[model samples]
Target: MQIVFYARVSTDEQTAAHQAKQAKAAGFEIDVVVADEGVSGVSTALADRPQGRRLFDMLRRDDVLVVRWVDRLGRNYADVTETIREFMRRGVIVKTVINGMVFDGATTDPMLMAVRDALILFMAATAQAQTEATKEAQKAGIEHAKGREDAYLGRKPSYTRKQFDSVVDAFNRGEAVAAIHKATGISRGTIYRIRDNRGQAEAALARWAA
Candidate 1:
């Protein structure tokens, strides 16, 4: 049975590498690492993503598929739930690194199955809600910057516009905050500050001619 580590990101090879290392640390020997870059878990269905399609093709009965979290599989509640159930139906074991959660189709007890299914629903719904909240926050941040454009310029930037944009792109592509910081040499706080308040930071950066 092949053990696969799947990641959804902007195709940063490092992300897959990181996941592989994580799985190893958890004592699972990975046979392959798959990733689809520039894909949004909120909008893209699993089968439609490039590497996602490959994952479907590759997984077989008894194969183990590992992800960082349920959110990586999808942010839509229905889609996430259905995808996981389908994989389990096919005898593919779904495992998460976050809590070492396991979803196996081998259980025949109806009550236990219902409990597992309910947990899947809860996690998927929470993931979707978090995605929506993030979108709302971004919108609010942009709107907040429209009237007071100069307010954000008061502070000295720890990173330049080029550096900030690079970090933002990686972050948007679903790269981990720590990975982005390490790769770009940007502090974690600055990367998040620029990401959460992109409009204000961008406007201020432009005004300063950065």
Candidate 2:
């Protein structure tokens, strides 16, 4: 059975690689990697994305699909839940890098199944909530920038220009937030803020003149 690692953006491609590496380190072998760049999981359904569609079509019974997190699958709770169930129904095993969570159609026990279903719902819901929170924070940052332009410029980023650019490039290449943070010593929030808000990040970088 083929093992596939999927991601959303080019930067997340790195995340996909990281996941593959982690899987390998854990004794799993990967056969393929797919990613869809510049797509928002919050808005797009899995079947609608180009690579996402390919992923669905490519997977076969007994194939394994690896993701950095449920959020990479989709941001909406229903979509995430439905996608996992569909995969499970197809005999495909869906696994996450974080927490090494596994979801499959292997159990017939009603209690066990119910517990698994509950976990799926919780994780998917948490993914959706995190997406909403990120968007809200992005909006808040922009709004705050509008009112306090000087303050925005004055605030120093935690990373130097060289450091930030390298991190940003890593992100643009599809690295996971956690992986990038681990390698560069940058905070996860800063990484997301830089990746999601390039204009603002660059403004801050210009102010630093690093």
Candidate 3:
């Protein structure tokens, strides 16, 4: 069975290496590392991420999927629990490095299963609530910033429209979407749009540039 490690950070400045090292130290023989950077966990759904989608496609029956935490999977509780259930149903084992949480589909004890499900649900809900709170804080900050545009000036852009364009170009050239994501830190939805409908992505990018 293949062993996979998935890590995510919301900013490009962060590296997944720390999480990778922790997983390795935990004795998991990781065969692949799928990571998403510069993708907001609170704003982007797990399944909608580039590396996240790749993980879903690459994982196989009996393969062990390791994550730093349930929060890495998603910020929404329903999405997080549903994602875990879907993987388990596919015969994949879900394991977390944090707290050593394990969810396997082979469990026959009803109580154990119920407890596991409850914990997953609870974690997911908490994540969603936290995300919502963050969004509210951001909204407040932006409104405050609007009153003082000059004060917000001189701050570096977290990401640029040019970087996203390069990712789209690479994708259009038939490069692997996962590879492009690893290199460019663009969102999966953007990659999908570029792959499925180049015209739409270009138009969206034009708007972003404006």
Candidate 4:
């Protein structure tokens, strides 16, 4: 009956601690806090996240996995649906702090199951759409960057490269995702991107290492 709280942020400036505090305020006795920083939810898959992957690995039957929202679980339709279903099948109860959404496997009513599944599918699809829109926006920004390459002095990096490395090291060592977010202020989306684009992020980090 362990309760696990998961939070994520997109940059080092945002802390998951706030989310954890919210979950605690909601009456969840959190046994662990998992946070992923610099993980962009828009492009990163839940299954590919370091802490996300660890969640699947560490979660046992009857454990409660609490997140701020379904979006926190993922932003993609297929990924979100699949992840939730898998956890439900494994006897994990997925709960959300914002809306008190609960998805469990114990329901025997076929209609209830169908409705639950459908809701999950719809929400996941919406999350995916949101992510896609974000990607397009980033693409536009990059294009803008290219146009100004000559006159533009690049903005300072959001974080020192070493900090990114440290985050990754902590992730690899199985540090809780919530802890990482609290310490680094990185968003959940950014954490996912970090896990998905380790090589690229590492390269960026190297370029910004100072």
Candidate 1 lDDT tens digits, 1-210? 999999876443335677667678888888889887678888898988988999889999999999877878998999999999999999999998766888999878999898888888987887787667555544654565566754655666677755764575555446788978887888898888877877666655655555
Tens-digit per-residue lDDT, 73-115, candidate 2: 8879999999999999999999886667889887789998999
The alpha-carbon deviation from the true structure for residue 79 of candidate 4, after best TM-score superposition, in angstroms, is 0.8
Say what the RMSD of model 2 is: 6.0
Q: What's the TM-score of every candidate structure?
A: 0.73, 0.72, 0.64, 0.64
- lDDT comparison, 2 vs 3, better candidate: 2
lDDT of 4 by residue, 1-210 (tens): 789988877655456897798788889889999988778665687778888888988899999999977878877777789889999999999998765778998878999999888878877786676556434534544554554535534444465544564466446435576767776777766776766765555444433333
lDDT of 3 by residue, 1-114 (tens): 999999987654446997798788878789999999888776687789999999889999999999877878887777888899999999999998766889998888999999
For this target, which candidate reaches the highest TM-score against the unseen true structure? 1
Worst 10 residues of 4 by lDDT: 201-210
* TM-score comparison, 1 vs 2, better candidate: 1
Give the Cα error of residue 110 in candidate 4, in Å.
Answer: 1.3
In order, the Cα lDDT scores of the candidates are 0.78, 0.76, 0.73, 0.72
Where does candidate 4 stray beyond 4 Å? 136-210
Give me candidate 3's TM-score against the actual structure.
Answer: 0.64
